[model samples]
Target: MQSGLTRDRLIAILMLLPSIILVAIFVYGFIAWTGYTSLTDSNALQQLSGLPAQFIGLKNYNDLFTGGLNLRFRIDMVNTVFFTVMFILVCLAVGMGLAILLDQKIKGEAIFRTIFLFPMALSFVVTGVVWKWLFNPTSGFNVLPTILGLPAGQFRWFISEERWWPFAWQDVPLILSILFLGIAIFAALWYWSKRRSQTAALLAALALLLLAWITFGNPRSLSGLNPERPEAHGFNVALIAIVIAAGWQMSGYTMAMYLAGLRGISEELREAARVDGCNELGVYRHVVFPLLAPITLSAMIILGHISLKIFDLVYTMGGGDNLYIDMPGINMFFTTFRSNQFGQGAAIAMLMLIMVAIVIVPYLASQLRSETKL
Candidate 1:
């Protein structure tokens, strides 16, 4: 019996060896090769004529981040930040709202859930095509007002050059200061609500305030002596149409995740809260929502990564021409395939990988630790 078992295990290992080797070669090997390529000078298509790749460590990265070659990278980075933030937040809000509604045992729950989730069944290309028509400034959904006997709406969707709420990239210090102050205020409120020591809360708030003050005490200090005074382009309102389309497609996935989480929660716990004088809203706010923190984090990470690496939707809907809708993925494609800048494109890919790793690695580590504890 022992000999037979050993032979079976060996056979299993041999059967899996091909898959393991393929994965190592195709996945990890390619990743290593890409990293090496990013550090080389392989830009022009002529360089691909069997010539050896020349080593040029870190130049591509530097050029991408700060070089005066083009504003494409910087602008794409800003647009990516705005798109990811808005996409994740809106998806979470809409998903959670839908999940909560479904959890209440509403009428036609099955039909409603199906309707919400149906969008996820469609491909990104299809979603983009549908939205492209809907956003056509002249002939598509924009003409509905005229059809309804109202004046035609003149809002330009993806082709608009107008921007609002603009602020220079050099003003990041001031932005961070304002954000830190707001966080400090929230931290103080949270501590007070939790009945933590007033002294501790006050000290925390004071420290944050001091940091903010140091960062942005003077506009001149924050802006620096030779800051690049580039034209500010605030959050593109054109992205609103894109966001709505993406959110409509993704919110259903989030809702399904959240709905599963809500269902897994024991009804007894909810009833117990009610028995303890908690209203529906209070129960959700103080108990149910807090309990779904893990689900929320999971959904956020998933949606955030999707938004970061998004290509098809933007490519199909905006055709990568709108500066407001440009992302690293589309930019990398254009740089490498269209413009034949292989090194810079590889660098962009590596940067995007790093960004995704930053968001995902911690959550994965935490999950492993929890599983180990279990």
Candidate 2:
């Protein structure tokens, strides 16, 4: 019996070995190769000749953040920050609303769910194309005003270059450090309230380490390593159009998550809340939202990574060359493929990976911890 069990386990391991090997090589191996390339001064000839590129340790990343010729990358970073925040907030709000409405056992519930979820099935490229038409400066919605006997609307959509709350590039490190400090302090307080001193202490330590790194270490040189000028960076109004498009496509996914979370909550718990003198709004505020915290965290992490790595959607909507709303992904593509600046492109890719990992790794660790407890 023991030999039979051992043989079964051995066969299972053998069956999984091919997939593990493939993932290790194609996924992680390529990631390492990209990291190595990013540290080099590779160009088109080297790529074509299959020759190793010269290493220039951190130059590509430094140039991207604080160098003279990389203003576009700075703009992309600022835009990413605002876009990620807005996209996640919008998706959560819209998804929660839709989930709540549908949870009331509305008529044609399945049809409404299918309709809402249909966009998630479509590729972002398709969604972007559709939204681009809808957002065309002089054509789509602009003409609707004229049809309504009003003058044609003059909104520039993605072409608008107007910035809100612009700031000097030099202050980036201080700004980010402050933000990190705020979050860390908040988490420490929350954990302390829960009497989780070890977790709270760990968060405080990590936060301090990050603050030190941003200030003194400056790995990506966020302190303006070699700025041409401390160029103004801020929230681009043009991102509103893209945000709307993205929110439309991705909110359905959040809705599904929220809807599942809502259903998992017992009806009895809600009844108990009512018996305790909680109204509908109070029930949701005090009970439902709190219970859905895990879902919210998961959604934010997932959406945050997606927003950080967004490529096809931005490319399809604004065109990579659109200075007003160019994203890191689009810029990376243009740099690598269009201009054959492989090293710089790889640097952008690595930065993006780092950002996504910052958002995802904590959530993953929490999940693993929960599973171990279970």
Candidate 3:
């Protein structure tokens, strides 16, 4: 009997071997090849024929960070940070709001849910095309305000070159002061919670003083690396339109996730909080929101990864020439296929992979450990 069982197990292993081998070769093998290509001076398209390539170590990465010729990469890096942060925050807030409303068991709940989720069914290409027409500066949706007897709107959506909240990159001292103030606020809260009111008050006072000095005492203008162009660029307002379109498409998915989380919470717990003198707002703020932490974290990770790798939507909507709305994915596509610069493109790809892994791997490890404990 033991020998028969051993033979059956061996047969099962043999049956699965092909699939395992295929995955290892196609998925991980290609990833290794890409990493290897990124370490070389492999710009020629003919290099795809397995010709000898020159290994240049980290020169490509260094060029991306500090090379004068790689200004587009640096600008795209800024755009990516702004786009991802705003996209994630807006999606989370909108999704949570919609989920909370739907959880109230309102009338026509199914109809409302369908209406909200319908956008998610459409592809990013479709979403981008529709938004592009809607945001056309001189035409499309811009004419609505004039039709309504309002002043003709001059907003240029994605084509606008203007930036807001402009500040020089050399203003690191001012930025640090603001960040210190934020830290002081959190420290004050911690101290107050520990019944150290005096210490909390002192911290708050110092933070205010530091903020005032940074704002009023400093008279010199902050500058960038190029001293000739002292005025630094700020957030591109053009991205607001893109964020709106993307958020409209993805908020429904987040709403569905948050709704599921809300439904999983026991009703009795909410009722108990209410009975304990918590109002509707208090219950949501204190009890319900805390319960939804896991859902929020999951949504953030999913949306963050999507934002980091976003390509089709921005490409279709903003086009390739708009530097204000450029992203790494678009840059990578142009660099590899359009410009025939495979080495730089592969470097960008590796950096994107590292960024995504940084955000997701830790969360996944923690989840696995929790499952193990359970």
Candidate 4:
């Protein structure tokens, strides 16, 4: 019996060995090697062996933060956070909304679904190039609007530095969409109540007054359109473009996942809600959303990860220049690589890894907890 047990244990270990080897080689091994490189002052073309690539402690890290503006270290960190947060939020909201809309028994559902998923099928490189052309001032979207008889010189809209507010045009719609949705749910409810009950006419009047007041309180100008300063124009444009394109591309996949989650939900729960006097909105809010939480959390994590590592889209859309403008995570890598600063480039990669981990760990913990309870 003892001999037989030993044989079984040995066989199990042998079977697991290859996966462990691969993880050590590709995962932990690369991470340790990169961490070592980050501590040294290595260059791209030729790593100076004679100079001793030994442990320099956090010297490289210190230099990165306080050494020179060439590093643009602080700026890069700020940009990474800013871009990641905004992109994740926008993608989640838009994707979920698309999922809900497609969930309805709409006509030509397959065609519409395919159109949405088409961008995700291609690599980000392809999507970026297409968007760049569509957004280009000279022969792109600017030309179309002007040719369509909107006005003179509106075609150069993307590049305009004056009152043209190029970035505003790009970023505003998404921001406004996000902002509007929060208000719209209540607005929709208010409208429904007013229509159903004549006694609630006064409440509808109050809601309209509130909406108009809020609208006027905020600036009418699109945030992306403002080119008050030269330094802001290019990066802003690139960031907005990338976010919109990515959000649109990934939305279909999110929708499909959500639809699957929705399908897995038994009809009996919804029927119970209906029997309990829950309306359509109430059923979705109380029953459907709670059951779908696990899938939604998964989608959120994927969206966040994609935003953090986004490269090809920005690369193709803005070329290598986007990094230089103000994108720290991207710009740092490009600049370091260009300057033959291999150590610094590795450090930048490490920084991005840390930031992404910060986001993902907490998110995953919450997801696991929720799932365990369910």
Candidate 5:
């Protein structure tokens, strides 16, 4: 029986080998290759001549953050933060509002739900293109004012270079310290509740170290990473239009998730809340919202991931030449293709990967810990 079981396991392994090998070669292999490229001083000529790429260590990264030529990248980072915040906030608000309305079982509910969700069927590229024309200052939405006998509005939309909520690069360390310490604390709380003492202890230690560093250590040394030390980073006003388009495209997705979560909730629980003399708002505030926390978290994680790697919409909506509304994606494209700076391009790609990983890995770790019941 032991020999037979061994043979069965061997056969299963053999059967799965091809898929495992493919994923390793295509996915993991490419990531490794990209990392290597980022460390090299590769350029168009070097790549074409089949020359051995010169390893320049972190020079490419240094150039992006301190060499002063890639200020657009710094702006892209600012735009991303503001865009992500507004996009997620708007989508959550609108989605939850819609879900609550549909939960009322109003007339033509199916039709309304379908109408709201129809945008999800379209790609971001499509949404961007449509919104681009709609936001034309002289024609699309601008003409609406004329219909009311007002002069055509002069909002430049994505063409505008205006900014808001400005901050210096010198303040980055403070933000990073707070953000990382918050994550560490959150992880510790979760693992501790699971009774995973070792993991929880490690997380607590990490949190303590971060807190100590922030409270006592010289965090100022880590600041001033931006190349243009005095240049301001801010919420680029041009990104607001992009946020609206993104929110419209994704709000329905969140609405569906919330609707499913709401429906999954037992009506008896809601009735209990009412029986306890809880008003409609109180029922949602105390019972419904708490129960829907997981769904909200899941939606935020997914949406945040998308927002970080946003490329196609911004590319298609504003075209690649709009300097006022440039994003990391567009910057990477121009660097790699137009300027043929493979090293810098790869560095940008790696940074993008890091940003997404930061958002995803924590959530995945927590999910696995819960699943294992440890």
Candidate 6:
């Protein structure tokens, strides 16, 4: 009987070997190849800046952590972390909040839900294209100030360098004047936020803020002030755009997941929480959230992985020029193709794979452990 069972297990493994091989080839194998490439200065893959490639083990990685010409690799590593954290938090907050709100027996909830979720069906490439048009400095909400009889060329939005961050509470006056001067900014925000969709709210808020900053905040606009530092360029704006667009798209799906998880929860638990002196917020915070931890963890892993591997949206949205791809991940693959440094490109791909793994594996293990205990 033992021998027969062993034979059966081997047969099952053999049956599954094809799929396993497929995954290895497409996913794990590709990553391994890329890792090998990163260790080499393989100029045969692609060439840029006339830098000939040779076997430079860990040199590229060192430069990546240190600095390169554009300082892009290092910047991008930081951006990746920042982007991942922000994306996960924003998507969870917006999605989970909307899920709760829409689940509250509201009328026309399905229609509203569908409207919010429709963006998920789109490819990242499509999302980027649409956002590019919407974010176009001259033609988009950036120009709304001028169109509404505000000063001509008053708003710089994404283009101006003089106005960036508000350092403190006192500097907030600058942020607010820039906010109020842009015509219809508040109106647009109100319209978007009145609905339950977080994407609409976020977009509207950004539009207003960017409008205000460009119109009132920029020193260049206030006077003929030349930039002391060079204007911020590269794919930073494009990355920002991609994050916003992708976050908007993903939020709806997250909302759906949370909604399902909420429904799965027993009504008695909520009532019990109330009897225990918990209000609605308290019940959600203390009871619902704890019960929903598994689902939330699952959702977080998905979003985290998605954020790490988010290439198509970043690639297609904007900043495709050689000057722009200089920003790291967006260009890393292109660099391999252009310079024929397939190995280096592969290495970048592998690095991204590692990042995704780092985020997901431990979370999944914990989730499984929790489920087993339950």
TM-score of each: 0.86, 0.90, 0.82, 0.70, 0.88, 0.70
Model 4, CA-based lDDT? 0.66
- Order candidates by TM-score, high to low: 2, 5, 1, 3, 4, 6
**For model 5, how many clashes?**
0
Q: Write the per-residue lDDT of candidate 4 for residues 1-374, one digit (tens) a residue.
A: 36555877989989999999999999999988888888877775555455555566677676665453443655444445556766777766776777778778689988988887787798887777787787776666556656677753443322322322333323433445546655655665776766855434544565565566455644333332333532222233345555667776787788788878877778899999999999989999999999888787788788777777777666666545544324555665575767878777778778778877976999878868979999
Error of 4 at 232 (Å): 10
- Cα error, residue 317 of model 3, in Å, equals 0.7
Query: Could you tally the backbone clashes for each prediction?
Result: 0, 0, 0, 7, 0, 12
The prediction achieving the highest lDDT against the true structure is: 2
- lDDT of each residue in 1-374, candidate 5, tens digit only: 36555877999999999999999999999999999999999999987999989999999987777666777887777777888888899999999999999999999999999999999999998999999999887778878989889998898887787878887766667778889999999999999999998999999999999999989986656754633456677777888789889999999999999999999989999999999999999999999999999999999999999999889999987746876677788888989999999988999999999999999999999999999996
Candidate 2 Cα misplacement greater than 4 A, ranges: 1-5, 46-52, 195-222, 225-228
Q: What is the C-alpha lDDT of each candidate?
A: 0.85, 0.90, 0.86, 0.66, 0.88, 0.67
Per-residue lDDT of candidate 6, residues 21-66 (tens digit): 9998998786676777788877762365666656778766654543
Candidate 6 residues lying further than 4 Å off, grouped into runs, are 1-10, 45-54, 144-240, 322-327, 367-374
CA shift of 347, model 3, Å: 0.3
Error of 1 at 162 (Å): 2.3
Per-residue alpha-carbon lDDT of model 1 for 1-374, expressed as tens digits? 36555877999999999999999999989989889999997877548687777899999997786566646877788778888999999999999999989998999999999999999999999999999998999878789988779988898987777776787766766676767767777787778778886855785868677675756576434443236555465887788877888999999999999999999999899899999999999899878999999899999999989998999999998856887778899999999999998988999999999999999999999999999999
Candidate 4: the clashing residue pairs are 76-328, 142-155, 165-225, 167-224, 167-225, 168-224, 168-225
Model 6: which ten-residue window has the lowest total lDDT? 163-172
Which regions of candidate 4 deviate over 4 angstroms?
Answer: 1-9, 44-49, 152-237, 323-329, 362-374
* Residue lDDT tens for model 3, 3-108: 5558779999899999999999998898788888889988775577777778999988878765667767767777787889999999999999999999999999
RMSD to native, candidate 2: 3.2
Off by over 4 Å in 1: 1-15, 46-50, 173-228
Best-to-worst lDDT order? 2, 5, 3, 1, 6, 4
**What would the per-residue lDDT of candidate 2 be over residues 73-114, giving only the tens digit for each residue?**
988988898999999999999999999999999999999999
